[model samples]
Target: MNKPFSDKLRAVEPYTPGEQSKNNDIIKLNANENPYPPSPKVIEAIKGFEAEKLCLYPSSSAYALTEALAQYHGLDVNQVFVGNGSDEVIALSYLAFFNSDKPIFFPDITYSFYPVWCRLFNVPYETKSVDKNFIINPKDYYSANGGVILPNPNAPTGISEGRGFIEDILDHNRDVIVIIDEAYVDFGGYSAIELINKYDNLIVVQTFSKSRSLAGMRIGAAFGSAELISLLKAVKNCYNSYPIDSVAIAAGVASVEDDAYFKNTINKVIRTRERFSQELKGLGFTVFPSHSNFVFASKPDVNAKSLFEAAKKENIYIRYFDLPRIDNFLRITIGTDEQMDIFLNFIKRYLSSLSGC
Candidate 1:
């Protein structure tokens, strides 16, 4: 039975996504999902889609969605590549650009998927440790390598690096590809899309999942030079040409077009995040300054794992990683004001009961 599996499959450790509970009663703040619903236009677009179109294959090129994103981001259509999800885009990126004898590099505490993709693609890679403060210094990534990939407003910690810092890394490693995963940029982080034109080595990946409230649609995209985009397209076609379906494409276009709704929802999440952060501090938790929709925090008195279990018992879900360097922190997504109030109240009671207050 073991002999039937591919060599790569045998060695691979799959990435674990945040827990998605089946209980509707649970306030899901584990995954950094947008608390609000998608734009009404996205719903209309999906509903208006012709059932007859399902009989035929979707456009392999995803032209309509690609063109819409290009227009939204002020890029040429050829510079944009659409995918089923940012995860797929990331996987394809590893296939397309990171194939080399030299090892690629990413922050040790960054997206867990980066190393997983490297293994799947047989791409050699190295991890650079982020500072004790959980900030990624651009200077650490100045070494030569196959390529580089890291999340901006990095996941779990939600720390964001500036454009100037990114430029410094690019300046040093001019010959290698630097992939910036901007999954949470719309919430509060600055996007690397602005630096794309100035640096040929830059590739910016973003998704509708977090900001546009379209995670169910599974729409994601990448922005790079035409040559790099073409390479990704080629790899994508080789794997699965019709990665994005008609329904998703239509909804994605509407999501991009409705900029006002996008802004309103993002602002709401940001406000909620800031409020949540302050409240956590008042409760004796050390909260990281998060530019993304989630906050990484720790309570000195209570164990994060214990609190995670305690929250789950009360129909609330938050992320707790048992991995080293971050085992103590809880990555809590910013839900609606009502939801956060419920969560905060629960934590307060839990801590009070512990101290017999």
Candidate 2:
């Protein structure tokens, strides 16, 4: 005999993260992870941490880290909500604001996790298709909806929408919550955090996993009106009171304080991404205009699944989505200049072999 599974469990298909291989030689450009390390301040903060504090519970509110983020973003402390990661913040937002008979709306090609969250929470959602170019038209979002959620500089496409476009969505959907998942904002996407005060229903969620080089810390945050933050906090309290631990809080505060390291690393990633995009085009790939840390591209002559296998054989990793509209494209993270150079060289050799040159 087996235990009965819940109806939700039967219906739910969990989100799948990008692969993490054990081989140390692999040049990992699959997941959109920051190639740089976290700020020295983060390491120093961890080194100086009080080991005795492990015996006590961490601050359930994550108050100190919240204050640091608040100062950086020019918001009141009450307007910030911290969670285990931005993914958690996103999941909590669904529970706090998106329960409705009217379906929430997101782009058809976007961060894959959005649909998973909707299914787990039992929130009805409709997937609105982006244009054939993979560009999201703001007009398509102007409709009756329970809520709106989208990632600017959309994943698997790496295209960022302008601030004016986001404002238009807010203008049309004034009655319901609009969640902007800004996980890649620091790369080149314009953050809607500036629009939060004007639109009470807008919630901008971000993560330290990308630009801050702190994916291991698992820190994510959200910004909105105080009332909106309060609702998320209430839901969080009901679930996990200490979503952020002491070490993570310390590292997050340190990462925020080191402005120089943050800008330097982000600038390097942006520069490398542009150069990589051009190199891909030279190799006969159609590289999309990307504002994120990765490029979504494909070649007319070569299949992406074939390239994925070829790259893996050479111990270089990139991502292939094997799904609708994007099956032929690969979302390759912009690693260090040296790493990308090696990847491009491998591509050249692969192309030469294919063409018998």
Candidate 3:
């Protein structure tokens, strides 16, 4: 019998998101989501959203949210592009810019989605391995390639490089598009938004999910030169003219306008992350220095897979990559203080029991 699926579809492996549990009682920390609720203004905006607007198509350009983001980042309105989420934005970007014969480059241990997009788009790509310390050597990116895309405060590892590091990459690859995925920048990483005007080849993508507490809303935006933004919009319109809905636009605008709430929430996550890292260290786990909402760690004597399974039994969800080099480590999101304490206490008891065994 003949298969019906397309050859490309059959060959590609989709990206796997963190496990999501529907149980309300579970201390869910697998996904790097904000522990707090969205701003009160966002709540009111969603509540006050006109139900009648659902009958009408949202702005194809997502003008209001785009305008809010442009103003927030001090960029011209034409320099902004909004999408369903940062993932969509980055995926569309891959389609728009990574079509050259030369392969694009990203860190080997960075966000898993980079390779997925490359395959889906039929874009050739190469991975530059980060050193033993999980630090992406800026020099590795300085090579002949179609383009470069990497996360600031990279995923799983959560290690962030400074503006100087990013600038060095831009300085080398001025001919091709360079994307800085800043999904976790608000946590503690320095943003590349300010460098947009200075580097026309650069595009900085950010999401409202992690920091603005709008993951459910699915609002993401990209900042770049007007020329690059135009290309992204062209690709987006080809795929989905109205990627963001009316309700999301209103919520996103409110979330951006409430700067005070955004800052406060980020500070809370930072404090909790620092304390949790120290606590994990005290427990003899090697915790990677994180600038994002999650920490990557491993205890030398314990099997990470075993610990992950044990945590699942207790209704505590965390992330564990079975991929090589990272299988021994666990990626734990920084939840609220009370939740962290609960997890810490469970870990202490679990280790004590292991010692007895």
lDDT of 3 by residue, 1-357 (tens): 356755544467999999988788999889999999999999999899989879999999999988998888888999999999999999999988888999999989989999998888889999999989899988998889999998998998999999999999999999899999999999999899999989999999999999999999898889999999999999998889989999999999999999999999999999999999999999999999999999999998999999999999999999999998999999999999999999999899999999995
Predicted candidate 1 versus true structure: per-residue lDDT over 135-217, tens digit per residue: 88777887779998989989889989787888888898899999999999987788989888899989999998999998898
For residues 259-344, what per-residue lDDT tens digits would candidate 2 score against the true structure?
A: 99999999999999999899889888999998889999999678999999999999999998989988988999999999999999
Instruction: Please give the lDDT score at residue 170 for candidate 1.
Output: 84
Mark the regions of model 1 whose C-alpha exceeds 4 Å error after superposition: 1-9
Worst 10 residues of 3 by lDDT: 1-10
Ranking by TM-score: 3, 2, 1
lDDT of 2: 0.93
Predicted structure 3: lDDT: 0.93
TM-score of 2: 0.98
Error of 3 at 229 (Å): 0.1
Model 1: per-residue Cα lDDT at residue 357: 96
Measured with C-alpha atoms, the lDDT of residue 118 in candidate 1 is 81
- Residue ranges of candidate 2 with Cα displaced over 4 Å: 1-9
